[model samples]
Target: MSVESSAHTAAPRRVVIENCAIATVDARDTEYTSGHLVVAGNRIESLGSGPAPAGLEHVARRIDGTGHLVTPGLVNTHHHFYQWITRGLAQDRNLFDWLVTLYPLWAGIDDEMCYAAAQGSAAALLRSGCTTSTDHAYVFPKGGGDILGAEIRALAELGMRFQPTRGSMDLGESHGGLPPDTCVEDTDAALAATAEAIDRWHDPSFDSMLRVTAAPCSPFSVTRELLRGAAELARAKGVRLHTHGAETVEEEAFCREKFGMGPTDYLESVGWLGEDVWMAHCVHLNDSDITKFAATGTGVAHCPSSNARVAAGIARVPDLLAAGVPVGLGVDGAASNESGELGAELRNALLIARLRGGPAALTVRQSLRLGTMGGAKVLGREHEIGSLEPGKLADLAMWRLDGVSHAGLADPVAALVLGAAAPLTLLLVNGREVVEQGALSRVDEEEIARNVTRAVTRLHGG
Candidate 1:
């Protein structure tokens, strides 16, 4: 596969993907075994079974979709891109102890390391069929040299859609938080920087490539003042609010002892339990907590692999979906999950839900929905990018089912969820091909891997 930057030129005025199995994932869950999807500019013009639309016959490019399965591009709701360099450290530690072990090492991060890590992680995600991802980078070393900007730059260079959260941690170990003082920032400085980032990078328009969110690190690692201030700032800026909530039992206990309530209640008290807020993990919610999330339209990013790796209890996904909570998929951090692959995360979500409940816990279609439409809803972009509809963005993933892994499957869609992982044959963001033939189009994966290795070695004192 050739690697070339696709962002410089506009996509072909029209593109027609013909003779593929299309999973529309629309409101009615429409699907077709042999169909065509027509794209005019950045939006999908039309898609249906049978021959190509009348005027699309003369499109500049017509990709032959034989032996391919087409679906809406996957969306990742939560991630920590910097953690890509710390994947194997703190092998056996749980949430709190894991942070204790890695906080010191994270303090050594610089702008170069941030760029390398984001490139490596985003490249892996793009190869695995994730076109849009939200990276919650909460560690702001006092003089880390614009780590957030470096990450955004890398994402742009890789040609992936991003929502990079301006995450902060103002309470340190000196103030009963888990992170060290070196990694925490002054409250006012953090808020001001966050606002500056939104002003500089946020694009609220349709089919935007980059958006910014304001995120406080976590309940135990940040102060109440920072939480309230971030929520107010995000709302005023017209962006969303994101944070870590109900991820572990220790976090829930800390919320109870410090705030005289559970995690959900504390979130509500901080003015963060609303439609514009989406939380990560959420493995420890109770019945009332689920009710509050559903009623308030708050979203949840379910990191099944990370929760299982850290031994955090499984989230009640069945119950959450049953209660009308908008639930999406996330790989969390590479340090926690050891990989940032959304395809594998979708399979893990299905297997873990069945493990928690019975055989009828979750369906393959439901798991796919969580990775696509559910993630768009969680990030408040459902109107533009979730489904493969006439007016939606032409972001898509094409998987080749002719490989050995899916040779004998009767249903390609079910085989995608049940079979072993397969690399995406093609991926597009806003009608531009960022990944083609299972490789990144704009960046060299070998160079990214080498740079990330050097950064990790430097951080590890090698």
Candidate 2:
């Protein structure tokens, strides 16, 4: 929908939250032990130390944020919303093996399944303090019936700021690709459909709640022609490009054997490396590959738990950061990372980085940045939704740190990142309340659960 069509006609709505610890996650990493934030309409009006300035009028809401920590709402840079219903299906497999096991079931998915899955995924993300999320949905069953639109409706109903890619796979098992023939699309058909989705759904306005991306699934599942074509189409349409790359050893081997080069090199050959592109996983990138990624301004969507779940080696996150590559945290697919908690990913990324590069590999604030500002940079929305600054979108999370799990922490940021997943006192997306008092405000959780149960049963042929 166009921004004008969906614009609110009501008078300006303002909310004030005080007595909270604010971590801006800006370039300077500004922090205030006791701060006040003002949200006017859909943007942050002002935020700084101490109470809000007096004489504020027409206040819509005033929150006593005692013992709470406020930060930018987490941004999930990569996900497969369609995989929510299929969680735990391939529990004991590597990346390739897991896809092989799940392909046939995925090939049978239709619009109904995708809507339920998208709802479930959005619910999990919001409960975990995620406001904006990008979905990489590549499996397009021929008779699925507008799967992308189904997911778009589901997320919009839940008030999620969404950037969903019209992902496609042109190379199938018949062509030595990973996905089955039924799950892949014709190269030209996929490109045309992607352009159609972009024209119909993409809104380039600054406060747009929905944007479209063009993504060809992966090296092993998409032909070189499709990759180059997708990149060209994305640039022409002013949308970003996303895909899976360097995710596992098997994928690296596949690229080397088939394309006579590494995954990074193959991507560069197809014009896939650029500021407009962000690749997921990237766990197997070598030093030279990291150099190219930095030089080309490419981004990485780091998925620590998913990599660990599939036994994919730890990505060199510290080295990647040192090389000036934009790295963001991702929950990945629920089928692989069943928790689907973007909040927990902050800690997971920290622990994994330390495991790979020692105690000081990643700081608590750095991990938080990965989920907030870094993610915004990767998705090219840094100026819009990454920090708690005036003129930016009021997409922020208020974590209740006074509870048993986080009280007396002294450092709110550390409590949020190193401690247990804190419950959100409130979650705001575009100055609108999505999660209030730790529950979704717009949709019933019980209803979402029931829908997911039904969808899963249907997918299982029950």
Cα lDDT tens digits for candidate 1, 1-462: 222222324445677788888998899999999998988788899999975777533365678787788999999999999999999889999999999999999999988898999998999889889989999998877667989999999999998999999999999989888889999999999999999999999999998999999999899888999999999899898999999999999998898888889988998998989899999999999999999999999999999999998999989999999999999999889999887898898889999999989889999999999999999999999999878999999999988897888878878778788888865888889888899888889988899999999999887888
Whole-model lDDT, model 2: 0.93
Candidate 1 lDDT (Cα, 0 to 1):
0.90
Q: Which numbered prediction scores highest in TM-score against the true structure?
A: 2
By summed lDDT, the worst window of 10 consecutive residues in model 1 runs over 1-10
- Residue 386's C-alpha lDDT in candidate 2? 84
TM-score for each candidate, following the candidate numbering: 0.97, 0.97
Candidate 2 residue runs with Cα over 4 Å from true position: 1-10
Clashes of each: 1, 0
lDDT of each: 0.90, 0.93
Give one digit per residue, the lDDT tens place, for model 2 in 210-328: 99999999999999999999999999988999999999999989999999998999999999999999999999998999999999999999999999999999999999999999999
